[model samples]
Target: MGYVMQPSRPIDWIRNAIRYTRHSPKRLDVFKKCVKAEKIDSKALLCLDIPTRWNSTYKMLDRAQKIEKAFNAFDLAHPNYRNNLRDGVPKVTDWSYARKLRNLLELFKHKTNNASATKYVTVNMFYIEMMDIYTHIRNMKGIDPESRLMADAMQNKFDKYWGTNNKGLNYILYFAAILDPQSKLGVLSFGFACVFKAEKKERDQRGT
Candidate 1:
């Protein structure tokens, strides 16, 4: 019984932080500043059957399943809670994640790379989980020094990893996603000089 109580305080704190952060002006500013506009190539992503992305296929499935379960728990905990929700909510069960997990488990059992639809589903599941965590942190409130420090650290990491003009994680993923499978020269890398130009073009096109 005492063991059960251990998680309550932290969970409640996280929940309250999540709720309050969803409405903060700082959070909104961060969202507008950090959320990048890019295309996701689900079909192409499915083609890359890289097992190194995860320790093992079974591990990948297990992690993805846990993520799915976490999402489900959060969903049931807060129905109609769209304050910080996105396309990644409800963490669909028996879907891509599950299929990939099952495929991965099979792969581990058989040691085969012929898993046709395994790659994209697992990758998408990861992307979704990361997006949710990032969004949650972006919208979270920091009332204490520790929380504020943690928030700042997370924000800085996001900015460092994904907030570059040309060589950012976003740019890498975008280029990779849109790569021509047959072409070695068609894929373009964004230069710092062109990043602003592309951003402006995107904004103008979006009428934002």
Candidate 2:
């Protein structure tokens, strides 16, 4: 579960690298003015991520990516900027990775927001969302070698929580899917057939 435990490492490093710029009032004001000049529809200040919240991290990276050029400009124009950030600033690759990671995390952010909605019952969404997350992890695994590592870690955690043998794999999730009007027993049967290659009787027994 390296990925699950450390998904924010890179973002944390980037944040640390730019901590001075983010905290410096002079640099922040200059960065804000530069963003205004460019007419970029972004906040006037950089967002520091809250450690406990993933969505806040996403928002921080998203805003940082948008104002990357402004940060560069500020760095170049401000005297003693390099001295202030002695630990080294984020490079182009770091920013690029942040952008990619932000995109990758968008699905989770959206799902989290949707699940928190108060207007409707969210139980029906559990099955589909879990499947969607599973597929997304698989896709990430196939994307590239680096992503493969992250995906592998995530997959390990996913299986730990939802694998056939895991206690977290309750029958209610399957029953919920079967109860959905759009995807009834047909979808459930197909899914079970794929997951459990045993006889129909065995699968039914497990379900019951």
Candidate 2 structure quality by residue, lDDT tens digits, 112-142? 7877889998777776777677777767866
Q: How far is candidate 1 from the true structure (C-alpha RMSD, Å)?
A: 19.3
Q: Top TM-score: which candidate number?
A: 2
lDDT winner among the candidates? 2
Tens digits of lDDT, candidate 1, 1-208? 0001112233233233334324556653332232221121121101111333322434434433333333344344444434555443433433453444344234223322322246553322322233444454444323445344444555555445544432635444444433534322232333333444644764697799
C-alpha lDDT of candidate 2 relative to the true structure: 0.70
Question: Which residue pairs in candidate 2 have backbone atoms (N, alpha carbon, C) closer than 3 angstroms, thus clashing?
Answer: none
The residue ranges of model 1 lying beyond 4 angstroms of the native Cα positions read: 1-121, 125-127, 164-172, 175-208
